[model samples]
Target: MRAIQITEFGGPEVLRVVDLPEPVAQPGQLLVDVAAAGVNYADTHAVEDSYLSKSTLPMVPGGEVVGRTAEGRRVVALTDGGGYAQRALAWEAMAHEVPEEITDGQALALVVQGLTAWHLLRTCARIAPGESVVVHAAAGGTGSLAVQLAKQFGVGRVIATASTKEKRELALELGADVAIEAAPDGAGLKEQLIEANDGNKVDAVLEMTGGPVFDASLAALAPFGRLVTYGMASREEPTAVTAAGLMGRSRAVVGFWLMHCVTRPGMYREPMAELFAMTADGRLKPQVGGVYPLTEAARAHTDLRARRTFGKLLLDPSR
Candidate 1:
């Protein structure tokens, strides 16, 4: 099998294509012929050994794949690693059959990015109907879907922040009520968010970028607002938040990791089924930014980290 291997910790340059023997499945696991692999921001962190969990040497970098079992069932698998390959192994429990209507790339998108967006709004944020929500990086994979899911969940308003005007427009097309520029340093970001929500603070925030964005989003929350931090794409330190400050404003700062949800029964399946249904019915559109051939994994990571792409980026292992 051909796979992207990283023997040393570094940047996208470390993702080198290599040929290795195919993996055999253990009991309760399925061997999948990888068709497409989802590329994520976390994959960047994983390569640098800076993720929430450290990476081991001589490992493949992707976790989500859309492929098939030997039995010919089309499925999406959540692997611990080795997804960026022509073949990978998945726990049967972590795999779901893909619908006939959903493309391989779209199914790959649903596994990590789709479920993360769903959990961010539905599980972590506990967003209420008529509540105002802000989704950062709203034009990216998770954020783009989150904007649509927020509307589907009947939020009163969806405020989207993106770094580019074109991306903001795309967010609006995806159902965000308003879209605003995300200034790099987050200068006046709180005011922009509040203003976008019609002179009021937001009820919940799905924040990924750290540093000033986190600081501003925290400040832009309404009383009793929930701020869920999922990623630190900026690789910068966030402003400190004290309990006293949270208590004074009656605000809460929460952190969510999708892997935690994978540990519980039905936690992963239920929301994933919902996302599948949404995608099937055309309610949820999983934006696919670009698809790279198996050997160009480095380029995919480069484009993603540089913010040069949008939606879900994928690697076509068959290519």
Candidate 2:
């Protein structure tokens, strides 16, 4: 089996393609022939040894894949690791049969980004209809889905922020009520959001970028507004939150991690089912940005980290 392995923690250059023995499925696991693998920020964090969970040296890096099982069932599975290979192991319970209408790449996107977007609004933030919301990085994988889903959930106003004009345009095309350029240092970001919402503070915010963006999002929240922080994509140190700062506005801040949801069976199952139904009915769509051969994993990471691409990046192991 061919796999991308990281022998040491470093940059995308450290991700090297190598031949490895195929893995066997343990009890309660299924061996899958990998067709497509999803490349995510979490994989980059693993390579840099910056994630909450550290990776062991000389390990194959990937967590989501769409492939066929020994029974020839087309399915999307969440792997513990080793998704960057021709073969990988998926827990039987975590595997979901892919619908005939969903492509392999779209299936791979749903496992991570799609589900995260669903939980961010439905569970973490408990968003309500008629509330105004802001989606950061609104043209990226999760953000793109978040913008569309926010509208489906009946948000009165959806404001999207992106670094580039093209990305902001993409967000608008995905159903955002308004799109604005994200400030480099997040200066005046709160004011921009307020102005986009017709001078009303947002009722909810989906924030991943930390540093000034995080602080500004907190400030932009209306009284009793909720902010869900999922990732620190900026790679900057997290800003400390003082209780007093939140108390005065009656604001709330919460954190979400997909890992926590996957470990709890009840948490991920229903939402995943909902996402698949939406995708099948055309209510939701996963945008695939780039498809790279397994050997070009390094280039995929380079483009993603540079923020030069939008939507989900996929690796075709069969190539």
Which candidate number has the best TM-score?
1
Report clashes for each candidate as comma-separated counts: 0, 0
Q: Assess every candidate by TM-score.
A: 0.98, 0.98
Best by lDDT: 1
C-alpha local distance difference test of each model: 0.92, 0.90
Candidate 2 residue-wise lDDT, 1-319, digit = tens = 8899989999899999899988988999999998899999888889988887888988899998998999999989898889999999999988999988889878888889999998999988999999999999998889999999999999899999988989989999999999999785788998999999999999999998888899989999999999999998888755647899889999999999998888786777788888889989999878998899999999999998888889999998877
In TM-score terms, candidate 2 sits at 0.98
Candidate 2 segments exceeding 4 Å error: none
